[model samples]
Target: MSIENTLSEIRDINLNYLMLAQQMIREDKPSAIFRLGISKDIANLIDSLSNSQLTKLANAQMMLARFRFDDCSILNMLTSYNKDSALTNAHAVMLMANQPVEAIA
Candidate 1:
């Protein structure tokens, strides 16, 4: 199957879940509250996302939480990992900037 088809299906399913979550939120359904953009049968992808993808997701989540949630919350699988990866990236950059670059022949 093509990537497009796979994504198209995932998108449809994700939308269904999003709607379900919204309805759940309004109906005071705890399960629905956590359903938005989240898959029920979550995949085990602890370090699957590339470094760039990980950083991007974390940044997106951080920005989303600033106005949406009271604080930066890590509720889902990708949440905590993204945030941690972003922090590590930041630290690595800082450490690199602080060090002197040696000239290579």
Candidate 2:
């Protein structure tokens, strides 16, 4: 494939990931933070951004998506078991966030 095509594919994938992240932020702040490996401050900042700002940020020619998996030990820990506890926890948090709060009678 041409360089341009490869770049275009990367751009599309990045855009898709950005969109999914934004949706997760809107749906569940804590889960988004955990999954995105971002601090609450950064998550809040992202949550507060306008759609245009998000679009501009996502559309940058080159964007860096940082995660906390740089350490081999951390990766090893998560992969030690058949199931990843971190992912399970994140999914739980998201589900809780989506649950409707009930008022006591």
Candidate 3:
């Protein structure tokens, strides 16, 4: 895909992720922190952002859509022998982000 298209897709994903994080914070702050793997301070910062701020951040096209495991060994440990389990976990993340899991793969 063209770079512009890729960037647009990233922006859309970022917006959706931010919006879901915002809702999770409002509904269940602790759960949001746990699920997002974010510190309370970061969660509070996310919670404090207005929708406009979120939109601006999304438009910046620098937000991440998924976490990258730092260690290859960790990734292997998590998904080496159980592909189904890995897929289920990924689907759960999509659900949490309010995205259709099927749309992902």
Highest-lDDT candidate: 3
**Decreasing lDDT order of the candidates:** 3, 2, 1
Per-residue lDDT over 1-105 for candidate 3, one digit per residue giving the tens place of the 0 to 100 score:
999999999899999999998899989999887677676777887899998999998897575556545445455655566759767566545544452222112
Off by over 4 Å in 3: 65-68, 82-105
Task: Work out how many backbone clashes candidate 3 has.
Answer: 0
Give TM per candidate: 0.30, 0.56, 0.68
lDDT against true structure, model 1: 0.39
How accurate locally, in lDDT, is each candidate? 0.39, 0.64, 0.73
List runs of model 2 lying over 4 Å from the truth: 73-105
lDDT tens digits, residue span 11-87, model 2: 67666767777788889988787667666777777778776776666665664364344555555555566466878
Summed over model 2, clashes come to 0
Candidate 3, residue 43: Cα displacement in angstroms equals 0.8
Q: Write model 1 residue lDDT over 1-105, tens digit each, in one string.
A: 996666566555544433444455556434432423232222113124444543444432112221122223322322445647867656544543344422212
Error of 3 at 62 (Å): 1.7
Clashes of each: 0, 0, 0
Better of 1 and 3 by lDDT: 3
